[model samples]
Target: MQQKISDQLSTTAERPSGRQASSPRAVPVLTLVSHPQPQRIGERLLLETLANTGRTASLSRSAPEFSRPGLPPGQPLADPFLSRTPVQFAPGTRGRLRLLVPKDGTPVRVAEEPARGAREFLPEELIAGVPLVLAERVVLLLHLTRVPEAPVTQELGMVGQSESLRRVREDISRVADLDVPVLIRGETGTGKELVARAIHQQSPRREGPFISINLSAIPRELAASELFGVQRGAYTNAIQDRLGLFRAAQGGTLFLDEVGEAPPEVQVALLRVLETREVYPVGGNTPVPVDVRLLTATDANLEERIQRELFRAPLLHRLAGFEIRMPPLRERREDIGPLFLHFARQELEAIGEAHRLTVTDPRAEPWLPAALAVRLLRYAWPGNVRQLRNITRQLIIGSRGLPHLRIGDRLEQELTVDPQSAGSPHISGFEDTADPDELSPSRRRPADVGEQELLQALRASAWDLKATSERLSISRASVYLLIDKSSLLRTAGNLSPEEITRCFHECQGNLDKMVQRLEVSRRALQRRVRELGLGGP
Candidate 1:
């Protein structure tokens, strides 16, 4: 057995050394070839290769791209991969396999054959949940026979390179290999679902179904049936038996978006499934066996909901096995330019507007000016990426011939209406003030009044720290502290973990608020929350 395994390894040569040869060479019993219509043609050749050699084979194709749907008008549609697929020759394929996109006309070689009786293969990277096993196998084969010179493009569409985004990517990379539930916390237009997709793409279960169910979008009456399946005769509208998100994602991922909106009963049912790895269909007698990696996301605070008895504690715990917080776009000001440029380039390419031009003229992309970038960085992005992309497209189309000059004017108009700035109320020379309530007999100073007014402003703004800070001409951190030191802490809700989180959120995550609202010092509050496994798990 050992000799046979060794012989197989020698024939396969699984690992490639640096800089493979450009030309295809024939071995004693096998040969590799390059095909022009690689994506479509390579699969057939791979079968031929494996049939002739009784060994593993692979096929390769050139990088492909396709325009993404659901983009707003005038916005550039993202194209991740247009054309390219892989074929792996194995007796029976099972488990996860990596997919690679190769440069044009690369030769594909066979390294290993599939194990017999293998029923399915998990793709290493996901393109809409379709396995790239055969396509990737081909690319691997080609790389072994002859390495390509150019680097491959791994993604199709989207923009922004903020540090917050980089951190998100790093976290996804770290957690993708594990089966832990991931909780993505972010506002609308923050791309929570996109992050989930990225996680699925980089995970071992990439080839299986990546099913998405918006917990908030589904009607209350239908949610249970939709999420947990239903018997054919379970309800008045039931015509046939159905599989739920759990079954759909049996070997892959189930993305539960707007998870905070799940009704209390649904939360309990979800918790049961999370803890048991099983689900009982609505009105069904038997429990369905399931294997799923749960990925949940929400903009609302589950902790607050739990406090209000609107969410289940156990469900929240199960969903938050790991947590990722998405920072709003305004906070990552540096990404504005790159994001704009990316959007503009995509739009120009998609419309074939620049078909005759090799390089885009700087003047044509007026929103890319250095001065405009500075202004964009200053204005807090209320709607995040989606908003920015829309504004960019608007600028591009609205400014027509005088793109540069018009972009500047449009940018100025945007700055004027920026909710962050225009929303603030001026306080003269408040920087020179101190904690002077100590000297006054009433134990209050003009500063105290100012602080209270700020808190009221924040409350009126619906606890939006950015708008509050902009209106007060102060930093968000300072406003966070000021709200706690003011009167808001006295009226905090009950002492549940969720309530504690709500109070802290209302306080903009200020340490002072945790101390005052919870009637505990900063350290104690932190320790208690951690001990209870509250907030972030």
Candidate 2:
């Protein structure tokens, strides 16, 4: 057998502080999304600090070695199909990375596009995560891990390592023990209730029952009585005296979800409870003193509601004593793999299909393909964590008794389609073009999309040029034209050779600077420079 040839990216050097470093201070990391070898799933490789500008790092078949998180440094990824040649990474000016892939090396795809020659990735792109497919079998995500959020000792019952989640956890730790009304804010399905639960679990009221109520789900007439206690015959069907959510959660916590949806009467009643620390039961004059702590959550715009007078100003001030924002699933994408696995394990165990994740055959294809995983990572996740959890459940249950997890029409719809319902999936956006290599900018339907929808798709696709095309139902060339037309995006291809050459020297030949100034793709600009016969910095 050939010797165990170990290959890895060089250790990166420490970076300077502030935006000079990574603005928010982040380091690049490589996570194995999945491989045909199921054991490689979720393994991580932390690309270390590059000591200086000139020094660089690399990745080949054997690159992610013993230094791989949770693995011994001496042990390399023993995949037999990977190429010996490496894809290189070097620090660019201002916290960006210059990437190079050899033409002769194993085939590589960046964001599902062929990765040939050179490219550059901004720090923001790293944060959003850059997906790489190697040799068509291995998938790795290059993303940023902001400093200080590098894994803590306790799990805190949360399943992600993203920086946003770390901040949310920190808020919980700081405000949990304090006696205050905690308000959790975020979009729907972003897990506002989870944040509420975490606070309650960590607070002094942990021992007491945690009562939860959804104000939006309750009828307006019953809302007040439901929140406060209802005395016998308070209204029809009010059988006996009832203890309200506040009294039921005595010495514990009362979680008011969808608090923005609280009826006008309920809002007034709630503000009084916050002021008096007691409730006024319906059909009674006596005030019932309650020791419950309040934790309310909302996806609605409470301030807007206040502007419209649908919600009371006093109530808004009362609920937001301490605010904790639950990040949407798209914002905390790095946690998706862990969160998916957490959900998958639960569902698999529930149906006695835990073994489904691991196929014994060495030659079998991975049930969860890298393409699917990358799609999951790149998806807008409009439904947030709840959406992802539901998708995970669907992927597992819908594939029952199958060798691989089946992505049904419904599951695929949930996975690939956007919130605006971009409609059905086509065979390929690249199809129907006469030139094949290039589609005209003046093509039909490309100009029909307005600026806002175009911008929306661009953001939703994380500025991926190809992805934006798919989202807009247009060709790549048309997408570029639309981008060039918009003030938001420009292409180096649009700039003249002379203009690029002049800027190249003005920036002291720093491609990163040129990228910032030219407002063009760094890779595209780099290529243009080479085409112009201007050299690298």
Candidate 3:
């Protein structure tokens, strides 16, 4: 299993020199477990076909080690290129792979050979104790010449192309050469983890482990042990000594996610870890030395918490060595398309599905109808990248069942509206009683709105989230949530400026007609009109 993984590391012909440092020896081993083959009849034939062809085409080869100039004639390269080891499955060796099905029940292999080019493919079925056959003559590529460039960026699948993202990337590039702690702030689902990964991937420590710890995921009692390591018999339930994230990430990067959720006691330990490159594990007498680049992220406003004395101000100061604030999805409309494509491609590849419509392909652009685009643009994605990924997954799964046109329309409709029942009050708590002029018609704060307009745009676009989002110049997912939070539809006696103006004009300034349309008492309408600067002057 380890050998299979090692071979796959350098299989890709054009990975960047930095990212290609060393592919995980655990990849192939994990892939077999994660993507298991079907267990139906003819599984053996499918496995054989894959073992003969598919895996080879998917492999990436590492680049040759380059020697620096002025080196002695016979000096070796700084980093020696790892040689590929020959892999022999041995006849009748079992394997497993995910079976492709035109429909749900019938399964077929997308590609036949599961391994090739000095690499072995572990079929999922063999891992599951099922017997399988391996191809006798599985020809392999030994060592291929390096290519000009890698086709994909190491950060390819991450979402967002907004100015905010670009700026964040710039910050990361700038910080790569330094050893300062970084604090990433964003709302939930804003891809804080991705930002941390990008920083680590681009830094000099790229070759080392990029360890992450979710402060919220660990229990308060165990937080100390998890972050600072624990000795055997440290306390009750201490079965063995354990190396914590800090030690595991020595000479690399350590990312603390949801740092605000950490308890006060743990915060002190973390501060000490940051100040001094030392850690005192539970039940240990002396502190161990550690060298790690620190990265922290939080959805909550740590500053506000600090002001309220909920969080230690000194700790906050320590973590904010460099801060990068991310804008919500609604704030950056231009990045929607690129983000959509990024997630779409990742989902398809993960599930072993063909490209329904590849991004960057002009032909595929036409397939993503203008209406769909508008829907996507108009809606606001409160859940941000995560919601978008989930929606894209649904679209892929749904496309398999319905007609292409219907599927697109269904997607459009869902994207625009609430995806629940039609006529769900657009937003709640927005009453018609307020004066029309009180709500400025001009775009005072384009980035901040109560959410009604976003939902209306969503419903108007037939729940085609992308199209609705575009029409409103926001993210589709955001529109859906805003409608729920704003309570626009459920609110009673609420009137928009346009609705009041239209009714007043149609009524020819008649109080009765305007009152009926506006759904307010005559006295209330008069007061509103006066407040709106529309009453007799």
Could you tell me the lDDT of residue 318 within candidate 3? 91
Q: Count the backbone clashes (under 3 Å) in each candidate.
A: 28, 10, 75
lDDT of 1 at 462: 51
Each candidate structure's TM-score, on Cα atoms with residue i matched to residue i, is 0.51, 0.72, 0.49
Ten residues in a row with the worst lDDT in model 2? Answer: 422-431
Candidate 1 lDDT for residue 425: 16
Instruction: Put down candidate 2 lDDT per residue, 1-537, tens digits, no spaces.
Output: 211101111223445543233333356777777666654566676656442224567788776562334335643445567678888776653344666788888787776577777765544456556777877777777777654334466557777767788898989999999999999998788888888888989998899999888888998888877888899987788899999788889999999999988877888888999999989999878899999899999877788778888889888888889899888775666677778777888999999988866655545576677678877876666577888889888888988888766788766754652312211111121111224332345444554878788877766765555777777776654554455446444445446678888898899998777766775555556766876779875
lDDT of each: 0.51, 0.70, 0.51
Candidate 3 per-residue lDDT over residues 1-537, each given as its tens digit: 312222322343336654544321212111110001110101011112123343422111121121111222221111112123212222121221222211221121112223212222222112112111112111111111112222233342354433356666767777866788999998777788888888888888989999998899999988888888999998888889898889999999999999999899888988998899899998898899999999999988787788887798889889999998766565444445556656656766776654444323211213333334344544546466677778767766665533231245545644653332211212111122332322335313223655666656645654444565567654333343344344333211234457667777788888766645543334435644655667741
Question: How far is each candidate from the true structure, as Cα RMSD in Å?
Answer: 22.4, 14.5, 22.5
lDDT of 3 at 403: 24
TM-score of candidate 2 relative to the true fold: 0.72
lDDT score at residue 308, model 2, on the 0-100 scale: 88
* Prediction 2 global C-alpha lDDT: 0.70
Q: Which residue runs does candidate 1 get wrong by more than 4 Å?
A: 1-158, 355-372, 400-537
